[model samples]
Target: MTTILVTGGTGTLGRLVTERLRADGHEVRVLSRRAQPYAVDLREGGAGLDAALEGVETVVHCASTQRGGDEQAAQNLIAAARRTGVAHLVYISIVGVDRVPLPYYRSKFAVERLIEESGLGWTVLRATQFHDLLVTLFQGLGKAPVMPLPAGVSDQPVEVAEVADRLNELALAAPAGRVTDMAGPEVRSLDSLARAYLRTTGRRRPVLNVPLFGKTYGAFRAGGHLAPDQAVGKVTFEEHLAHRFGR
Candidate 1:
């Protein structure tokens, strides 16, 4: 059995991947900032992380920091993996990180580069934004009387479970550098997505399309972070909402 270590193994996607791998009879090791038995920070490398990586043949890297320091985390992981002679490293990254100008997106792309040059056998999968994130945004926005959204912005939100399944498959296979992109089934406008959330959750709020002036927003407006061609995911945002809310 291939013993695979999953970073950020407790997160939405990683947790699913961990469960799937274990169910399939693979020995799964979970590593994260707070995961029990291997709660070491990847950014702050130490013997703790090294100890976790020992005998870890494959690493499914799902750990990511949107606040910052993702590049540092990848570097630390790469260094540790090299030392431990880990054969395969699988990374999950956001789609259009190379085209998007957002700071968080830039950091994701930088981490992708770090993994690419890490010299360890690696596979990277770029996926669209998860549906749960849209839910979070709408939840926050619905708190106010008026919801504000970037003008001309569209999103293709995929189910997190689907992304997790793909990651699990990648972790089990031989390293395939930069696999095909994963995307949601539909491309809907943010305004429409917000409306769907409001309608489903019964939140009465006027959605305001606020046109923001910035290169980052412009890129979003231009659909730089979208993948209309690779819409292969089976679940829809509404289906996810039904299951999440037990409706």
Candidate 2:
């Protein structure tokens, strides 16, 4: 059995991947800011990182910062992996990072470049938006009687559970450089999805279509953020809603 070290093991995707790996009989070591199995803080470098990664052959690098100091943090993690002589490193990335001109996405792109040039065994999987995005969209829309859908925006969101399963499989396989993109089984328009979601949750709300401004919005509207052709996810939006609201 390979001893796998998982960074960000307590997070949404990380947690699931860790559980799956452990259940599959791989010896799992989780890196976290706090002590559980192993303690590591990629942001603030120290002996902790070195100790946690020592003797681990494969690493699942799920640690990410959506804001503040993400680049430096990712670099630190990479440096630690290099120093420890890790055999393989797998990074989770979003599909739209190259097309979208968002700050956070730019950081992810930068990290991918770093991993490529590091001369280490590496694999990157670019995943689409998660089913959890429905909750974020709902929160953004609030309780308005008529919610404005960003006109022309489309999505091929995946379930986090499916993403986790793929990550575990990657952890066990030989590094393939970069894997095929993963996305949900359905192609969905933002407006229709939102309306369906609200209805399923027993909410009565009308949707209004409106064009949105900015390059990020434009990129999304042009279907730059979706991966429709590579629909590998098993969960549907309705199933996701039912899981979330316990319907």
Best by TM-score: 1
Q: What TM-score fits each model? A: 0.99, 0.94
Question: Which predicted model would earn the best lDDT?
Answer: 1
For residues 146-172, write the lDDT of model 1, one tens digit per residue.
999988999999999999999988999
Model 1: worst 10 consecutive residues (lDDT sum): 238-247
Candidate 2 local lDDT, 1-247, one digit each (tens): 9999998899888899999999999988988778565776788877888888888889898888776666787788778889999989999999988989888898988989988887789999999989897768776794787887888887887999999999999999988898899989998888878977887788877788897799898888888778888998989888898888899
TM-score of 1: 0.99
User: Against the true structure, candidate 1 has what lDDT?
Assistant: 0.93
Q: Model 1: residues >4 Å from true position, as ranges?
A: none
Question: How many times do residue backbones clash in model 2?
Answer: 0
